[model samples]
Structures are given as C-alpha cells and as structure tokens.
Target: MRNNLISGLIFSFFLGMSWLTKADLYDATLAYQNEEFTLAFSKFSRLAQLGNADAMYNLGVMYLYGQGTEQSAANAFAWFSLAKEFGIAEAFQTAQLVLQQSNDQSGLKDFLKLQKSRLSNTYLLDSTLTKLKQHSTTPTLSKTHDVLPEYPDEAVRQGIEGWVWLEFDIDQSGKATNIEVIDSYPRHVFTASLLNAVEKWRYTGSKQAHTLIYHFATHKDEQYRETLAIQKKAYEKQLRQNIDAAERGVAQVQYYIANWLSMKEYNAYQLLRYHWRSDEPMNELYLAAAKNGLDLAQYRLATQLINAGAHQLGVLWLEHAAQTMDIAKYRLATVLLNTGEPQDVPHALQVLIEASNNGHLRATLLLVNTYLTRLSDKAQAKAWLRHGLIIDPEHPELLLLLARLAENQAEAKKLASQALKSASQRNWSSHAIHLFLQKLAN
Candidate 1:
C-alpha cells in the first residue's frame, strides 16, 4: 500500500510525459551534456512548446548563455518566468539573476506584462471552460475530511485576494488524487494552499473527478463589509486627528499615514478615500518619519529608494532599519550579496543569520543558497537548510535541496520521499525529484 501510494505520487509527475516527450527530453539533455548546443536547443524548444517545465528552464539557460541562440536576457526572463509558473522553483532565482546581470532591461518589463496576461486566471479559465463544456460532469460524493485552505502569508502581506479552480479525482479509498489547477485569479498565489488542502480531502465514493473553486478573501463576506462601513464612520474622527497630528510633525503619525497610504485600497478601507487621493504623497511622509529615526519608516523609505535606484542611500537607510527590522536585515543581506564584493559576503552572511534568528524564512533560504552556491560550504548550507526545515518542514524547495545534498542513497531517499510528499500535497510539478527517485530505484 505504501509502495502504491509512492508510485501514484511518482506517476502524477509524468502526466503529459509521453514516450516521445521522454525520449526528446533525454536526447536534449544528452546533447547539452555533450556540448551539442544547437541540437539541444532544437529539442528543448520542441518540448517547451509542449509545456515541458524542464525544457523551458533549459531553453532559458540556452538563451542566457548563448549556447545555441543569440544571448537574449528578455527571452531568458520570459522562459524562466514561465518555468517558474510551471513549478521550477530555481527558475525564479535564475530569472532574478538574469535581471541583475543583464546590461539592458529595455523590454523585460513589457515582456513580464505580456506573460502576466497570458498566465492570468481569467485568460486560462476562458480557454479551459471551453474545453470543459464539451466534457460530461461527474458528481462528487460526501466529503470526509475537507480541510479549509489557509491564506498564504505573502499574499496577506501584499493584500492580494484571489481564487483557485482545482480539478482532482477521488480514488476508491476516498482519497483525492490527480489534482490539477485549472485556473487561479492573480495566478499562483493561492494555488499551494488550495492544492495542499484538497490533497487531504476525502470523499465517500468509488472513483470520481471533481472540480472546485476556492476563494481567498482578506475580509469577511458582504455583510462584514457593511459592518466595516459603519466602523469606518465611527473611526472618522480618529482618522482626522491622526492626519492633523501627522501634519503637525508627529513622527509616529507621519509613519502611520505613510503606511496607510502605501497599503492597497482594500486594506485601507473606505476611510482613506475621504482624506487622501489615490496618488497620495506618501514618500515625503516616509522620509520625514525615517529622518526622525522611525525604524519602520526607515525600512519603507529604504525599499522605495532601492526601487528608485538610489542604492547608496537605500543601503544607508537599510543599515539603520536593520537594527530593528528583521525584513530590513534580510533585504540588506540580499543587496550585499548582489554587490559581489568579497567583504560584503561576510557582512551579508551575518545579517542573514540575524534575520534567520528572527524567524525570517527568506533569510534562512538565502543563507542556505549562499553557503552552497557562493561560499562552497555545504556543511554550513546543510545546517541552514535544517534550520529552515524547522520553520517549514513541508517546504518542497528546502526538502529537495537537502535531498540533493544527502550524503548517501538512504539519506537521499528519506529526504526525497519527504519532498515528494510535500510536493504532491501542493501539486507542484517535480519531475526532477521523480526522475532522481526512479534512477535510485533502478
């Protein structure tokens, strides 16, 4: 039964993996390994057209290094972005590297905009719904354990609201299987939660396919909104007083105003509409608060400066902010690492450790990546990876990385199985891990 479950998980990774597709990918990988760039490029391109994630990543690499095609950062970014969407976690970091290393970013923004539209839930849903109209529907039986999806922290922080449409089959044992994301609003944010929750869902039936849409809202229903409107009216006096204090040079009030201004409209509520326009001059408020030694405002101002290309100023602000903000320390560490200075590496590692100690997940991951990739310290990397696992045991990326660095086949298998379980629960495409396990089994 355990073997069957593992086999089922492995089989899911090969959904669109026809014999021809498998052969082509192997040929492409072999050609690349043999330095036959042109043939490798051709084969990868063919597979990429058929929506192969690994092929897309390889194609991005080819474009990045001018292996068989003209070196094109734009093309590399587009392909890497697509590969990331298809669940290649490293592709996102690669895409960021492309941007950081590129001489010209002229068309990259436009390309990303185009990709966003193409990958949008609305766009994908229209095409998928058309296909579904031709197919017959299957009824869902009683649900035994339907876990409600948790809202993603990043999405909540960004005030992002979206929905995911999922399709999955319920096996004879009342377990959901063969889960797929049909579409998702804002694309990808809510998907992990939906997939993880759905994978645990059980139904009392033989075998059946079911479709579901899960909505993620930061707030409650329409009735809650109506109640919120009344509450906003009650808070109007306090809002006016806060604005008055901000204008009267109260640093805390200034920071509060800036923070409120920077928030999304949904997060800000309707009261903000009564006082400030959409184009509120929040930067000045942030600057004022930052100058007054407000750590939060300093962090906000630092990010704004960094985005606007004031690197030196941003770094100075971040340095100040880092003393109080874990996220600031993380950002500062990333900047130091990107600077590529030998002295900066130690400083970056120090700040990353500080951020990690404060329970910042990205900082921990960056520390692991830095030790493994940049510093060539696998021991340190392993230690940091273990720390991150403590924070998120089910994190597929961390698990997969640890699996790759496993000292022996037994360790590798143990880590890989954990990774496979996590990835399966989240419905993440994990062909590389699947293939690795298959090789080990052989």
Candidate 2:
C-alpha cells in the first residue's frame, strides 16, 4: 500500500515538472516573438539548465547577437556545444562558424582536438540576412557542388509546411556564397535546412546577388494542390464567360478576351488556360476597343503593339490612354526612355513632370533621376526629392534618395534612419537601407 502511494506521488511530481517546462518554453517563445529579448533570455536560461535543446539554442542566439546579454562568442559557443549534444543540428552548424571566427589559437586547437581535428561537413550560414547579398559577391570565392538538405525533424513531426526566401551572391568562381534567409513563412521551421542546402549550391555566373525560395512540405502539399485546382477551374469558367460576352459585342469583355489572347504562353497558363485558339487572332478587337477610347483597352493594345516593335502605333495608343490616365503617362515615358533615339526626349520629360504633378511618385522619381544623370542637374533632383518629402514626410525611397544626395554624413545618417523607420512601418523591404547604413557605419 505504501509503495502504491509513493508511486502515485512520484508520477504526479513528474507530470507537474513536465507541465512547468512546457509552460516555460511557451512563455520564452512568446517573449522572443514580442521582441522582449530580456525576458526571453531569462526564461530560456532557466529552461536551458533543464536540458531543453531549443532553449539552449535560443540562449546561444541571444549571446551571439548581444540581445538581452553582452555579445560573447565564447558563451554562444558553449551554449551551442551543449545544444549540439542534445541533437540540435543547427547548434553544430553554428559552432563551426565560431571556430572560424575565434582568434584564440589555444582554445581553437583544443576545440579542434575535441572535434576530431576537422571541421564538420555542414556550414554555419550568416545569421544576418540583410547583408547576405553584399557578402557573397564583393570578391571571389571557391566553387562548390549541389547538395540537398535533409528535412527538419520537428517540422515534419508537427505537419508544418512552408517556404524560406534566401538571398546570396554568386562568386566569380561560381560558388554560392554568403547565403542568408531573408523571409520564412513559418519562421524557424525550415531555416536550418534551407541554409544548409543553399551553402552547397553552385552557380556559373559573374559576381552578383541572387534570391531564391525553398519550399518545404510533406502531406500539406496535397492541400495546396487541391486549392490551386479549384482556383484554376474557377478562372477557366470566368474566361469562357468572358469569351461569350465578347462574342456578343461587349467592348469591355472584348478587351478582356483580347488581352488574354495577346498574353505570353506562360502567363496564359497562369490564367488557367489549358489551350489557346491558334486559328483565331483577336488583336483587332483590342484595336477596336482602344479606338473606342477605353483607357485600359488602349493601354493593353499599346503594350501589345509595342512588344511587337510597332513603335509608332504603340506610341499613338499610349498617347490616347495618356490623355485620361496617370499610369499611361508613366508607361509612355518609360517606353520612350527604354527605346531611346527617335524618341521625343523633351516631350517625354514634360509628360513625366505632368504625371508627377498628378501625384505619381514613380514619375517624380524618374524625372528626378533624369535630372540627376541625363541632365546633370542636382538642383532639380534635390528640389523634387524635397517636394516629395514635404508631401509624405515618411516616404522611404525619397528619404533614401535624399540620404544619397546629402553631402554631410550626419544628414545622410539621419535620412537613412528615418527611411528605415518609415519602411518598417509599412512592412516594406529595408534591406537596401540596411546596406547603406552598414556602409556608412563602416
């Protein structure tokens, strides 16, 4: 009877302990997500002592980044070493990087002895992704072969599936270099795997930044397949209906069908077209609708004609749409610039200025660029950027341009800081700004 009672108490004690550990991990993760790094560090530290692999890894990250703690490579390396023994593969990967960066020869020699005198096959990717592109291609690097990564165990167990977006550079020697994960749908689920795989990829190209997406899925891919099938069916039905309407002489529907017909093969497939009519040429319908003074139809017809190198007809159609549309004015100016020679450069500048006056920021930027480069008028460029800043004080690109134009480093830094803040508010890409800031800081 006493043994039974003792057994019950022991079971209850372990159950409570398990629950507390789970709760602590949840809280730590929540704190990290909330950017409360100090609280995360505290919770994760407590959990790490309890032999939680995830907590150990998190602690390493906090120390490595100086988040909620002073940056200490030794501390991060120690945490990662502990986590690596706990079967967290990422910990081992990072510890490799620590060895490379450590200047203490005696410590590295001892560590190498412990690690069997050789670095592991896996690599430690750059933890910071914003500067990944710059790191990869500024100089030359060694070439490598393709090696696919294994699927993450935790993600597979949880039935989680998503993708990670990475940016890197191809070195002159054709190696994939300085790879970093810029975005991940499920955050940490596939980061390690994506990083490992990209590290081994080789590209035969000159030094340049490149971006790629890695998708992870198991059973969940079927769900996406089903959803896409339904979407395709719906799109096909709409296309058929539009064709019927177009045949009945509806100008809008005629434009829609004509536009679809004129689209490239890949784009038509994206619109769910299993087949296109080879016997039928419907550009005439587009021309008719454009001649009838529909702005969208005119734009579509203009692009179609322009792509075929019928410059005069394309410009004529663009002018017709430009009469009533801001987008048309921007497109016309862009086309004129791209085609060069035989273009009315002065008239195009007028069109851009008129478009900018209509609140088209793209036109403003283009005109500012033209003034800066084509005309070598910094005054006009500065005035335009200042005007844009007045309209939208937090306009990120304008602020970035202002930063670039600033002669004083202090003013440039301030403008870049404001640009980063503004971009973050809108969830816009701030990687370029980060690079600019990094360059200035250096």
Candidate 3:
C-alpha cells in the first residue's frame, strides 16, 4: 500500500454517484485511509465497474499515485474521463493534471485518449456496469479444507515435474466427488497422488462443477540441480543448432532465438552457462530478423520501437508488416488514430477497414468506435457493427453495441439478452445483464 492520497478532497469526491451505497463508499475510503491499498483498490474497482462515478475518480487517483496498483497515467486519465462523463466535475481537472505530470506527456495524451474512447463507449459501459451488479449477488465458493498431493518417489527419482488439471463437483455435505482428471503433463505420473489428495478436499458446497490445476514442481535441492544440469545440456545443444540455422539466414529461427534471448530465463542462465553472448547483440537479433523480412518479427520490433518512443520508425515497420498481417494493420490503425493528426485519420480508418474485412474483432470494434466517436458517422458505425455481428454473431461486444443502437425498446432488449447469453463465452462480466433486463422489463 502506498500513501499517495494527493489530498483529503479525494475522499469527498467519492460521493458523486448514487449507484454505490454510502456504506460501501465509506468502507472503501476507510480502507484507503488505513493504507490497505489493495483492499481499497479492489473495492473501488468493483464500485467503479458498477457505474459509481466517485469510485471511478478514486481509481484514477489511486492509479496516478500507484496506491494499490502500478502507477499508470493512461489508466488515471481514462478513469477520470469516465468519471467526468458520469458528472464528476473535478475529474476533468484531475485528468489534465495526470497528463501534465506524465514523463512522456505527448505519448501519454495519445494513450489516454485511446483509453477515453474505450471507457466512453456507451455499449461497453452498460455491459460492464450490468455485469458487476450481477456478480455482486453470486455466491462465492471457497475451500473449507485444502490438501496437497505428495510427490511420488518415482517422479523424484526421474526428476520429472508436471501438472494435473482436475475437474470435480462438490457434494451437498461439502466433500469432493465425481473427480476426473481432464489433462496432465507427463501422463499418469502424478494422477494417482492428485486423485487421492482431492478425494479428501472439502469446500463450501455450491453443487457447481469446478476445475483446478495442481502443479508438482521439484524443490531446488539436489534433485532439482541434477534436473537443471540435464536441461542445460539439452538447451545448449539446441541453442547451437538454432544458432547455426539463424546464421544461415533462416528468418523464423532467427526470430525464435531472438525471442528466447529476450526471456528472463535466458538472462538468468546466460550468466551461469552462456559466456559467449551479451545483452546488446541479443537485442539486435530481432532487428536482424525484421530486416530479413519476417513479418512477425517486423511487428514485434515495431512494438518495441513504439514503446521506446521511436514512433515514426515503428509506424514505418508496422506499415510494412500491415501489408500482409491483419494484426499489424490493427496496430498501425491504433497508432495512427492515437496520433490525433488530421492527416492520420483517413489512413487509420482505411487500415482498420482492411483489418476488419479480414475478420479481426478488435479492429472491427475500433472501427465502430472511431466512426461513432471520432468521425460522428453513426450510420458507418452501425454498418461496421452489423459486419462484426456477421463475423461472430454471438460476440458479446458487437451484440451489446447493437443493443445500444437498436431503434426500438424491444429490439434493444432482444439484442441485450442475446449478448447476455453469449457473455460467458467471452468471460466478459456477470449479474448486470439480469439487472439491465429487469430495468427493461419495468
């Protein structure tokens, strides 16, 4: 928990909307004042998702100050802008202040604008709020007694580490029953132990099925070191092969080695085992692959460059990759749109349309948002929404957007209900659909 409240006025600012009960707001504020940053953040997030304008403001402040979560000027601005839309008068000033204090002010503003576009989408906001309200009433199942599997001696001797994914149901008396091993790495090595342990497990009975993954990792003792030695030998052998392939101008292998070099494991193991390479050459590996015309490598390198603030160069690489990659087109469109330059808007829309035509969901959604919010072309937005629905009729986002744009109340409710039915597939949210439907019924 970080004690970066900025001022006492933040507490008073939490009173903006009536969606949250006074007691809930008080508890969240009290948690923050007591330096229980994580708890405060969780509570405020739940409240904010449920359309509590004040909670949105509090989340913005917390994000700006890195109170319970990572400090993010972009997130702070987004939440503040959302709160402003909900009638929090101070949110605009707070958003501007966050932008002013940001290290990369120009880039921060673009990212913040992107966030605002997302948060301000009425279809998205309603879905989020409705889902939160619904989830609030759902009963949470918890383990009453926990059990861990004892690692098999044979597994230890073989120096094998694996995981088992188990699916089971809880009986009325809170005991585990009907246990089935869904999948396991290294086959049946750990299955018997896992089954035996899970048989004794207890939970607060919900009669609902649940899935759990139990990982068996050997401790970093003598056995683990032996396993590591074996793995390192194999890794070195493969590394030599990959290096040979990379040197022969195999673009895919070059990218693979570059990706491996970028991993934390490579850094940790390189100091211990690989004395042949350093950080700088590994960093250039992606550049080499990109130069060799690996589209994926080009996209990856472009992302790195953009994040590092080399926007012009990144956009150029993105354009090259976008000629063949739908995802790259979407990324290029995002960057172009974020620039907020008049000349960039048409190019952004063009690429987004190209990506959307290829059935890229995110690109389609962005296109709809751009047409609706930026271009103020409701007919184009609706047309794209319809196109998106054709791609994935059950997609909750597209359905929700259609629901919000429906010409009549009955049509709106039907679309919304359809969105709610398919929401579980998207893991979008819960509970709000019921509340929203109830509101519609009344």
Candidate 4:
C-alpha cells in the first residue's frame, strides 16, 4: 500500500512537470508571435536543448532572425535538421529554406548525417525509429531541394549526384542576365537540372550589376542527364574575355587614383575616394583631399571618422560638407540618430525626410515607424502607413500594425486573421493564431 502511494505521488509530480514544460513552450510561442524574439529565443533554445522538437524548430527561427544570437543560416539549418529528424513538418520546411540560402552543401551534408546518426541512436526507445530509418535511405533530390539550376558537362551523371559550380551576372533589377557553368562533378546528369533551377532564381536589387556564383548538387537517374561540359568551359572563357575587355573600355575610372596622386588633381580626389580601401594610406589621401577643399572628399573623410567613432572630429568635417552636399546632410542625420541626443532629433528628422523623399527605403521605413509608434501621432502615422502600404503592401510589420488599428473588434479580428494567414505562409511566428484558436474553442 505504501509502494502504491509513493508511485502515485511520483506520477503526479511528473505530470505537473510536463504541464510546466508545455506552459513554458506556450509562453515562448506567445513571445515569438509578439516579436519579442529575444525572450522567445532564450525559452525555445532551453527547451530545444532539452529535446523538445517544437522548441528546436522555434529556436532555429530565432537564429534565422538574429534574435538572441547572431543570424547564421548554417546554425538555423543544423537546428531545423535536428527537429526534422524528429518528424516536425515545419522544421523540415525551414531546413529546406536554410539549405537554399547556404553556399556550403558539404557542411549541410555533414550536419544532416550527424543529425540522422543522433536520431538513430535516440529512436531505439521512441516510436519514430522506422520513419527515421526511411529518411536515411531516401535520396536527397527533389524539386524543392534544388535551388540553383546550372552545371558542367563532366559533372553530369545520369545515375549519380555531385556538386556543380556556376557563375552568373545579376542585373541591377536582380534578374540573371547571363549564366555559365564553371565546374561540376558527375558531370553528365547534373547540368540540366542545375541550369533549369538557376533560371528561376531572383535576387535583391542593387545599384549596379553584380556577379554571383552558386554551387548545388542533387541525385537523379539517367533520364535527366545532359552533357554541357564543353559548352560550359567555352562560356566561362568568354566571360573572362568580356571582363578583360571591359577593363580596357573605362580608362578614366581605371587607375584614376594613381593618376590623381601623381598629378595632385583635387577634382580627381572625389573619384579616387570611391574605390579607396579603409587603410592608413587611404586615410592620408582623404585628409589631403579634405585639406584641398574638396567637399565630396570632406564628406568621405567624415564618414570614415564617424565609422571609427571619432564623433566630434567627424561632425566638424560633416558640417563643412553639409554646406554643399546633400549626402553630407544624410550622413549627419544618421550620426545624430545613433547618438540619440534630444537636440539632434529635429535636424535628423529634417535630413531623414529629405532622404525619404529622394526614395531611400531605409529612411522611409524609419520615418514611418517613428511617426506611427514612437511619436504617437496617429493622423501622420496613418498617412505614412498608407503611403508605405502603396509602396510595399506585403510588409509584415505594416500589415500587423494596420490590423491592430482597425476601429471595431470584428474589423480588427478579420484583419488580424488575414495578416496571420500571411504570416503563416512566411513561416513567421504563429503563437497569436494558436491563442486565438484556443480562445474560440473555450
């Protein structure tokens, strides 16, 4: 009778512990939903290390956002893969996204192998043993897994999988302008899929065209094999040749610094500063240029000084530059914001408004947020939010904030529901939705 009583007490204690864990997880989820990512990250990471698959998935998301830790796609992949091994569907999707962003396939393969091995050992007492074994046997090849789509002929193998490297030119609009395979392994079968996948890739827009390289690999059988090695080699050669040709096309921009140093041309000082590295020599050059009364050079020197945290000295140069250059005004505004002095806010706001009007998205977002949330000016905030919606309707923060601003409860609920749906699609935190569902059920 005493043994039975002791056993009952032990069971009750365990049950209570289980409930506490679940409650912690629920709280973490709520924090994540509210974008209190730091708290969410700490809670999720603790639970994850304790072997909670759901918590592992959430922790991976926090890493992706740089919440409690630095943003690391590799760490995110490792945690997501760990959760994926436990058969978490969300983790599986997140693992795939992390893999897509990763440039290192070998690292991912190592991580996946480690996770599988760990799971195999753990699952001896778990019901997921069979599923884990099945995952081990399946080939890592599918439409969703293949992010880059280009390969070399030699690396294309009809029945094998290996890595392929390719270089492509991305235009200012973020579209692939030209693609050429640099190298591949198991060359025959890999090239076709690589090319097909790469053609669909989109990049964030930049001011100038940029060159990028991607490495990808997959497993497939002979039916999809396509030989493109010779073609790839020839294309790479042509790309190099084009680069060499372009060097000859711009004589003024090329070696402009060398010419400026010899001629001591103050006008060429501004142009030279553009390509200068952040070193002592560059600093000396900038000082000389600033002394020569070049406003652009003064602005560049001020930026360097600000970055080095010599705020007082930087401000002196910036004030001089601001007399003639709009860029100097923008830089001064940024410095003021970072310093957080009450006296600087008005000037910062003025310069930020100018920059926003000139179509700087960063300045625009900052300005809008300041008006809406910080300053508490609802009318101005609403106007800014409406303008931002027109510019970027799909921005998550804006959508969520708008939902919160709805006049009636029904309207608020409807907008929140829609925003939550969109957030789910982006795999953003879903704690709020879960809570809302719980409330409805109760």
Off by over 4 Å in 2: 1-249, 259-278, 308-313, 339-343, 390-392, 424-435, 438-442
C-alpha positional error of residue 118 in candidate 4 after TM-score superposition, expressed in Å: 70
Per-model TM-score versus the true fold: 0.46, 0.40, 0.47, 0.33
Model 1 over residues 1-442: C-alpha lDDT tens digits?
A: 5335433433353344322114336567779889999998997875564345667777777887789999877888888878777656666766776776666675785786786665453223213213323433434367887788887876655445556755555555566654545456667888888887876777787442255656676673344454555565545766788776665456666665655664454434355555655444465555555544567666655655565566675677788788877777877998998898999999999999998987777778889999999989999999999999898888776888898899899999999999889877765556667888998899
Q: What TM-score quantifies how close candidate 2 is to the native fold? A: 0.40
lDDT of each: 0.67, 0.61, 0.67, 0.52
What's the TM for model 3?
Answer: 0.47
In candidate 1, position 206 carries an lDDT of 45
The TM-score that candidate 4 achieves is: 0.33
Report the backbone clash tally of model 3: 4
- lDDT, candidate 3, at 249: 50
Q: Whole-model lDDT for model 3 versus the true structure?
A: 0.67
lDDT, candidate 3, at 426: 38
- How many residue pairs collide in each prediction? 0, 0, 4, 18
Order the numbered candidates by TM-score, best leading.
3, 1, 2, 4
Q: Least lDDT summed over 10 consecutive residues: which range in candidate 3?
A: 123-132
